[model samples]
Target: MEVVRSKEFIADCSWGAKDLASMNGISTRLHWTKEPYKWHVNDGEEVFVVLDGKVEMFYRIGGAETSCILESGDIFYASVGTEHAAHPIGEARILVVEKEGSV
Candidate 1:
């Protein structure tokens, strides 16, 4: 068994993460970031949860761009081939679940 205090978690670099659990080909991770991530489409589906702070999430739909702000406890689900990016309002902690080895 393992315990993680999300608010107290920090990483040496932006988007750095700690593995929390894995089953089959899926993994759960805690990520700390203060910078925006590059827009890209995941090969598989992804589940993103804001654990602390705020994030402005951007995504492309049919060549059009749209975004939304996510606060603590907000969840974002990205299906396969969904182009998306996440920009932290400041320092933020996020919980991510996706296929193992996906980026």
Candidate 2:
């Protein structure tokens, strides 16, 4: 129900990097130097776009772990059923729209 501009959001660039639509069930996340960890989707899918730095996203497909490195301007996504995780290979800024009602 609002607009976010990355170049202006002073505290967290990830929160303001994109203009997000108010979804039926949705949320957003911004990770900085908080922690180096992996994550997985419990229910729905999420679409992400890297604003800065680099992130390595891994997912298990066909019993194989597939990896992809996302950099600035890179747009990537994972579905609800995908067994995936992500960690900052280096420093990274990303915007994610996570499906609401999901863990």
Candidate 3:
């Protein structure tokens, strides 16, 4: 038996349960989990699409909170200088996109 896994960022879900589709400047990540964590983006704009779960997309602005709920097919985007986070309420697969030069 043999098992192959991605050597990229931390993947909390099953390695074989998800497929990663990526190009030189863009990538799509898939996952299935009810667990949650905080994601940090150093700079640039980021977009997230919820594939199959309930999610709470939150952002912090000057000590206040702005948020939204994302279900299947729902998408959210965070522009530069906005600190945002997400929490999974159910199992899901998420897609994240970033501009080519926007690290």
Candidate 4:
């Protein structure tokens, strides 16, 4: 058993993550980032939750690009084949749920 405080979560580097759990081939992770993640498409669906701070989420669909700002407690759902990236407003803690080994 373990307890993680998202507000106190910090990483040694940008976009560092701690694996929280894996169930039914789905992985849950806690991530700390102060920079933007690379644009990529996940092999499956992704559930992105902002636990602390803020984030600017960018996504491309049908070759059209769009973005949205997400505050703490906001959730972003990325379906399969969705290309996306996350840019933190400052230091942010995020929870990501997706298929195992997805990128």
Candidate 5:
């Protein structure tokens, strides 16, 4: 068993993550970021949870771009083939769950 303090966790660099678990080909991770992530699509669905700070999440659907601001405790679900990226308002801590080895 292990205890992870998400708010207090820090990464070595922007968008760096700490692996928390992997089971049945799915992986859970805690990420720290101070910048925007590149736009990309995951091989499978993704669950993004904001644990601290704020984030501006951008995505494209049917080739139409959209975005939303997510604060702590907000959750974003990205279905498969969803093209998305995250721009943190500042230093932010996020919990992400997705397929193992997925970008």
Candidate 6:
């Protein structure tokens, strides 16, 4: 058993992550970042949860780009092949669940 104080978690490098769990090829991880991640499509679905601070999530639909700000406790779901990126408003902690080894 373990306890993680998500709000207190920060990484030494941007987008650094802590592996929380893995089950049947699905993984749950906690990530801390102050920089933006490059846009990419996941091979599988993704569940993104903002645990602390805020994030500006950018996504594309039909080659059109759009974005939304996600506050603490907000959740974003990305289906397979969904092109997206995450830009932290500042320092933020996020919990992400997705197929293992997905990008």
Best by lDDT: 5
For residues 57-83, could you state the per-residue lDDT of candidate 4 as single tens digits? 999989999999999999999999999
lDDT of 3 by residue, 7-75 (tens): 232456632134455567665555555676565553677787876667888888787888888988998
Span of 10 residues, lowest total lDDT, candidate 6: 6-15
Candidate 3 or 5, higher TM-score? 5
lDDT score for candidate 3 against the true structure: 0.65
Candidate 6, 1-103: lDDT as tens digits: 8999999998889999999999999999999999999999998999999999999999999999999999999999999889999999989999999999999
Q: What ranges in model 3 sit over 4 Å off?
A: 1-19, 99-103
Candidate 3, after superposition: displacement of residue 59 in Å?
Answer: 0.7
Off by over 4 Å in 6: none
Please write out the lDDT profile of model 5 over residues 39-84, one tens digit for every residue. Answer: 9999999999999999999999999999999999999999999999
Where is model 3 poorest over a 10-residue stretch in terms of lDDT?
1-10
Q: Could you tell me every candidate's TM-score relative to the true structure?
A: 0.98, 0.69, 0.67, 0.97, 0.98, 0.98
Taking the tens digit of each residue's C-alpha lDDT, what string does model 2 give over 1-103? 4655543333353223333444566767544432344556557777877776777878898879888988779988777687777666656666777875455
Candidate 6, residue 41: CA error in Å?
0.6
Model 1: per-residue Cα lDDT over 1-103, one tens digit each: 8789999999999999999999999999999999999998887999999999999999999999999999999999999999999999999999999999998
Which residue pairs in candidate 1 have backbone atoms (N, alpha carbon, C) closer than 3 angstroms, thus clashing?
Answer: none
Residue 79 in candidate 1, Cα distance off native in Å: 0.6
In TM-score terms, candidate 6 sits at: 0.98
Q: After superposition, how far is residue 100 of candidate 6 from its true place, in Å?
A: 0.3
**What's the distance in Å from true for residue 74, model 4?**
0.4
lDDT per model vs. reference = 0.97, 0.64, 0.65, 0.96, 0.97, 0.97
**Cα RMSD to the true fold for all candidates:** 0.5, 4.1, 6.3, 0.6, 0.5, 0.5
Tell me how candidate 5 scores on lDDT. Answer: 0.97
lDDT of 3 at 80: 82
List of clashing residue pairs for candidate 3: none
